[model samples]
Target: MYWSLITGMALAGAVTALPRLDSRQGNGQVKYAGVNIAGFDFGCATNGNCNITAAYPPLQSLGGPDGAGQMQHFARDDGMNMLGGTLDQTNTGKYDQLVQACLATGAYCVIDIHNYARWDNQIIGQGGPSNEQFVSLWTQLASKYASQQKIVFGIMNEPHDVPDINKWADTVQAVVTAIRGVAKSQMILIPGNDWTSAQQFPTKSGPALLKVKNPDGSTDGLIFDVHKYLDSDNSGTHTECVTDNISSAFSPLADWLRANKRQAINSETGGGNTASCQKYLCQQIQFLNQNSDVYLGYIGWSAGAFDPRTYELSEVPSRNGNSWTDSSLVKACLARKAS
Candidate 1:
């Protein structure tokens, strides 16, 4: 389900995980850190069209609503090198603009298809779009950015409620093969069922997805994707955070990733700019940094397209003239330097 509330304003973003090999030196430092600049995916849903009009398109020419400017700020000021939100597949023109802006920042951009394993509320490969159709989407995308090393293919966004996890793996495998056909070495993030929940990853979706292989029969750049929220219900809608999710999620999953010599990314995570959030969110990031060997990096929930004065979980840094002030949660947690 589409969780974040969208209004008639600009919010564009994407979260990308960098290659782990660069920062996997047994040090407590995350390689990739950034926030989502959400906008293009605003009008989209499982059973609807992404109303391009409702979203503020952060094109290059638009100065204040400049999506590119947001990315540049994250990279220059916050030391972030990965930025993005979700992509509207039908709106390729806007997507092209978003990618160009991301490229200008010298950061990686995750091209996420925010369909949640379904098209029109029907699960892909199960009853909705056939596996071939899904493959076609990736094939086209991979071909488009075949040479851009900074581009990461997020196979799908937060797949959940599927009847068979194994079947989903098969579908992912097909897309992997198709992507490899064009973009040979780019990273492909494979997510599990149950909203790609970090707590349930190792047990539910990890095993089946681990078997997915590349065209050459090796899992070279295929990274696992997971999401976690700090609220009581893990819905991410509330401002209060009740847990750090260490034991309930990250710890066990860390063990699994290490055991298999695989790495995963917390593609989405964040909390409100409040005391409770500041405490738990910082702790959660520290854990990921400490275990950076298995945990590649993290991308906060959002920033782009959101008005800091309005959005509840707004991670967007406040700007006054030429100055940019990061939210407390971002400065203390999401954008915290790797130590």
Candidate 2:
């Protein structure tokens, strides 16, 4: 199912190349597009009951075309019991399916760890695997996927309530450096702390993250991964969207990226099926279109084979017998203007 669309020259000059599951071959660079796959990393599986049924994904999405080439997910969280300080491999099959689905669509997939600032509710600085262990976890994961160039590593998901933001940034840099050692070219997504909220990004965690330098102190080859839901408080759980939250919250991040000559992708966003909610969703997409120079694209809150539509943000395509159809929200996302 790997596909490509030959579009005009380049949509804003050099859209990042979307690699394949096995080979990087394609017509040329395709603008990145994506959706998030939740549950595996933070749901019952992470809690220790190990809900294998929900762990696997396809978590299917609406048909038409896979507009977003990226699928971000919690590759690892505290769900599976880690051996010593390493990530648990007991539940790798579920994630393998997710990676495979992204590859099938010829889209780059972002595998994010679902743990917030803490693991098991304990702060990183207080008590957790040392920084070296954090690096080790990624090192092992990257080594396994080294041959899969299309897979992007989202080191951690929504780190929040940290004691030291600067130290956290340094940890993020260290994680990136470690992954580079094993996986040479895979893109790394650096998320800001304070829940990685777009509205709170610039002032809270974006600065320290910007200061994160490569081995040479010159940063490149990374993108900021931020999330913004349409709810009143931007909580993914809610269905209500306050009048201007999306505009005000995300605009600042777009401005900062534009000013800094950097780029980012909204890794998560969603709302219930209401005119207002859909309006905000469409507006946010348009907002990104206006800032294509500094914005890559966005990923809807989620959709998955196992993700029941009962979830407020579930965008998993409708299961039509053996086939699948698009949900209204996914429909709007696919129709977003391509700048």
In candidate 1, stretches whose alpha carbon ends up further than 4 angstroms from where it belongs are 1-25, 46-53, 60-64, 86-90, 337-339
Q: Per-residue CA lDDT of candidate 2, range 1-339, in tens?
A: 000010000001122352222211223212454445444443332212323343333333432222222222111110100000014565565456545654554445667665564555565544654688778777888898888776677777676677788888878888888887887766677888767778888788888888876566545667887877777666667666554355577677767776666677666666765667777777776667565656666666655432444666655555444444556665665333321
Model 2 worst lDDT run, 10 consecutive residues: 1-10
Model-by-model lDDT, in order? 0.77, 0.55
Counted clashes in each candidate structure: 17, 8
**What lDDT score goes with residue 32 in model 1?**
78
Candidate 2 backbone collisions, by pair: 33-68, 33-69, 33-70, 34-68, 46-79, 59-304, 59-305, 62-326
- TM-score versus the correct structure, for each prediction: 0.90, 0.77
Instruction: Point to the candidate with the largest TM-score.
Output: 1
Model 1 global lDDT (CA atoms, 0 to 1): 0.77
**Poorly placed runs, candidate 2 (over 4 Å):** 1-30, 42-86, 244-246, 305-309, 334-339
